[model samples]
Target: MTRAKLFSGILISICFGLFLSACSNGESESKDTKKEEVRTATDAMGEVTIPANAERILAPNMEDSLLALGITPPAQWAIGTTVHNYLQPQLKDVPTIEWDLPLEQTINAKPDIIIFGSPGSIQNGKYEEYKKIAPTYVFKEEESADWRKQLQVMGEIAGKEKEAKAVLEDYDAKTKEQAAELKTAIGDETAAILWVIGKQYYLFENSRFAANVLYTDLGVTQPEMIKALPKAEAAWNPISLEALSDLDADHIFLASLPNEPGLASLKASSVWKGLPAVKAGKIYEMEDPSNWTSNGPIANNITMDQIVSVITKK
Candidate 1:
């Protein structure tokens, strides 16, 4: 063959090979794009049909639960500015609303659904107004302690019930394991959980609040004094600082409000320093104020870790 003809033949062969490779690559890319378009069920507050690619969402209080279920809403209906620190990274950009109050900003967001952590304030009239704008769901106050149930309800609403259930089961198993370990480490040491609010304090009893996890879930015994306090229908009972000495627990899990004067007052009080738990250096200060009262999924996990760490560390 002539040299020019031989060169032309080699060039054509190379071109043909390149064309086939490009076609193969294009086919694979098309398949991958189609697979990526596939949608799955998302469970939020209740059973609602959500597109696998739901763009706009509004989470008011249960940010932790939503995060646990891998649902990151584009917007958050926040009660306060500081709450942003508590939200998962996916929700940090969401705007904040007036704490526990309905603001026009939230309504303007035009979200598909609004999930509330606390609905009592909204129930009086605000919730109805919100319903006119979008589907709104309030967490069941009765199931406050059952975070798994809360997640399940959220998952069902978001159309991700199965995922929520699995997440709940996993969290429950971890909690149970940690609780068992905490029980062994702490042994029979009695503990009291308290929140320093303003100049007063509130003690949590086993049946009253989520603090029951310390007793019911973690197998920690309640201090006799806290157990003897007058039981009310509420989760916590308010007591005077003068009564601090009466809460004779082996250890005290005290949560103070950040930048609040309550801690200063408690420290200044002679009776507080004389308490057996205080003198023995058994007070575990909780840095996260939300964990002291929040019943959300992340808060529950935070509480469990705090309990285990405090008990086991000692």
Candidate 2:
């Protein structure tokens, strides 16, 4: 071979080697980028540290909050069979440990943690029992007030506190903006929020679920009839549909209760057609049950959007 040709061949070999090396380096960097980070956060119970990436998460309550943070657990414990229908689509596939959790089933799963609301469930001695199986957390179910706080707390337990904070902050800002828009759309209109559960109709005051958003956050006025009702004893109180006339407001938010007897009775009542809101078609029927009672991060957004839609939709 010619001397020049030999030198050229050597140069080509060196270039090929460098190209392979660059490709290998790029592959390594891609793998590193895909690696999951070990996240940590603190809650009221104590400091929760999820080692590396938590592969097997078990959530008992606050499924909506977990769904909001884009985390889906392998197993979850539902408040009841009916509650599962309220969860987001991603969470609907997870297996539930039944309404009242069995101690043995929880221990057998060997979950990293167990999250639950309803202080009674925690205080009833189940919390201690479950802690033996995993780190158990009890979050409050204050429909409007404690949802964000609880989401942060649960996020820490699931090793996703930063994500939780971001989700909650965005939800809060959007809720504030939507509330302002709703107030402007319904200016000076008195509104009342009510649910027809079983055979009774319940009007929510400041303390009930979603009431704080209407009464305190959006600054919407309430009718004197509803205002005169005693403060909700426990999130909601049952009222007779016979008293519908007493609940007269410029606008009425009738929570969707599919096939609920109270709803049928109200529709059938002779006085119902005469009510101002019903006659004027000012009643807004809540199609999404999640918006009525959920306190999760996504629920806040849903509620805000629904309120704005009902108030502004022509």
Candidate 3:
């Protein structure tokens, strides 16, 4: 009878151990489910529920805005054969997908949230499909082009509003400090920016892109040629080569798209060679094509650093 009792006790102890093991596994699963609980985000398309503290993020087209917000996505969107070279060091090994991401590709990446520069394009034919895969957010039409507003909305969605505001404030302080230094370095010297795309020559107007960096941040004087034109409604617009002569600023900032042979052709034009900035060796060739045309707080910081390096070295 005693031997029988000992065997029964051993069997009961084994069952208890198994029960405890099962309960521990159940608790772990409960914690994981809690971590993945859905949260709400409102965008142009209305409210969408996404995984809280999204472990993986994918922005097919607006990687610039995300990077500017200090959020590095799992992958960046690629346009044709081009990627953002200016952000190379930060995104060195990050993978890329087509601008209009394929459903299968996006699914395989397993993004908890997806963002787009413009997801409302019917022609893209993937907006709804993307929504099916993950909680997608699209910037409003008016705010899409404005980087400041983009950052604000992005911060709201990512729970980084305070960090975003701090970034902007820091940028403002840096700009003010740089402007003062630049004033002492080169007082009242006017500057102009020229971008060449294919056969077209474009001059940046007041209050955007490089102009925002040059005139607003660095406090560089705008050439009368740019001032005479109306405020910039678009980022860039076509200007005749004859118009290039009107940009008689003391310093000229020049840049062109990658693999663009137009800079050579523009220089070959007697009109370009005869410009005052060129003749006086005051023309500066901007190295990074990415930030020179786009506007974002981080891009603006890079713009300031590049220009200051050149001017201070001189």
Candidate 4:
């Protein structure tokens, strides 16, 4: 073979090798880009890097905020057979997940991100275990308490900040309109909320659950009985029927589960029957107490509608 021909053949081999090296490097760079598609977010547990485009989200009790932001989670929060009935219209098809979020069930759900309602919700020191399945974000106690703020934080986590802001703005406008209507109907009459579950009775303090929507947002006057009580330490605080005899509410929003024995017991009690709201026929019965007992954007909105509808009934 001629030397020049042999040199040309060697040159062709070198060019082919370089071509392969460039393609390999390009492929590696593409993979790295895909791997880096995440953002560092500060949760209650501190900085956590989560997927920028998380698709399969699992926020148990905060489903209302998720739904408000137009996101559907893989599972709804439930305790055995109990689930938030008011939210079932939107989340009926979703599977039920334990309130504490069991490991095997979470793994089966295949969540890309798991946003917990509060640090307390991350029980049994299983935060690390959940991290193995997907990124986890936890809300602080105070942050979890305020549903509006919960909505905003979840929005930031889900990359829907604008949607969160818009939701609040629209909700503010809605409350403003409804507050005016409520003022016209009730006219400074004090209102209180009574939640009956089974044989237990719980009362709402001024800022707990949907009571915040009633007295704070919608301008419903808080009864002296409710105002005298301390701010609620938990979602539900039991108040005895005897203590409730002192209630000076002109209107009482009675929230109870269907077929609850507590309602019958309360109705039979002379103290309950003698209450001013009951005597005046101002006892507004809310058959579905799901929203009143829970807190979130969707929950609060439904609560507002429920209060307005009952107060303005012709």
TM-score of each model, paired residue for residue: 0.74, 0.76, 0.82, 0.90
Each model's lDDT: 0.70, 0.70, 0.79, 0.90
Model 4 clashing residue pairs (backbone): none
Off by over 4 Å in 4: 1-36
lDDT of 3 by residue, 97-138 (tens): 766676777888788788776546423566788888888877
Q: For residue 164, give model 3's deviation from the true position in Å.
A: 1.6
Root-mean-square deviation of each candidate, in angstroms?
Answer: 7.5, 6.9, 4.3, 3.5
Candidate 1, 1-314: lDDT as tens digits: 99999999999999999999999999999998777543433322444333333445576656667787888765664555557454545666666665554556767676777666554546455766776766565666654336667777677666678888888787779878987797677788898888887776878866544476677767788888867766546444578888777888998888876666888888889988998999999898886656657666666677888888876884
Which structure among the candidates has the greatest TM-score? 4
lDDT of 4 by residue, 1-314 (tens): 99999999999999999999999999999999898789898888999999988988999988999999999999999999899999999999999999989999999999999988778888899999999999988888778778888888888888999999999999999999999999988799999999999888988889888889999999888888888898678655577879889988999999997799989999999999899999999999999999998888899899999888888983
- Ten consecutive residues with minimal summed lDDT in candidate 4? 230-239
Candidate 2 weakest lDDT stretch, 10 residues: 36-45
Of the two candidates 1 and 4, the one with more favorable TM-score, higher being better, is 4
- Candidate 2 structure lDDT: 0.70
Please say which candidate is ahead in TM-score: 3 or 4.
Answer: 4
Clashing pairs in 2: none
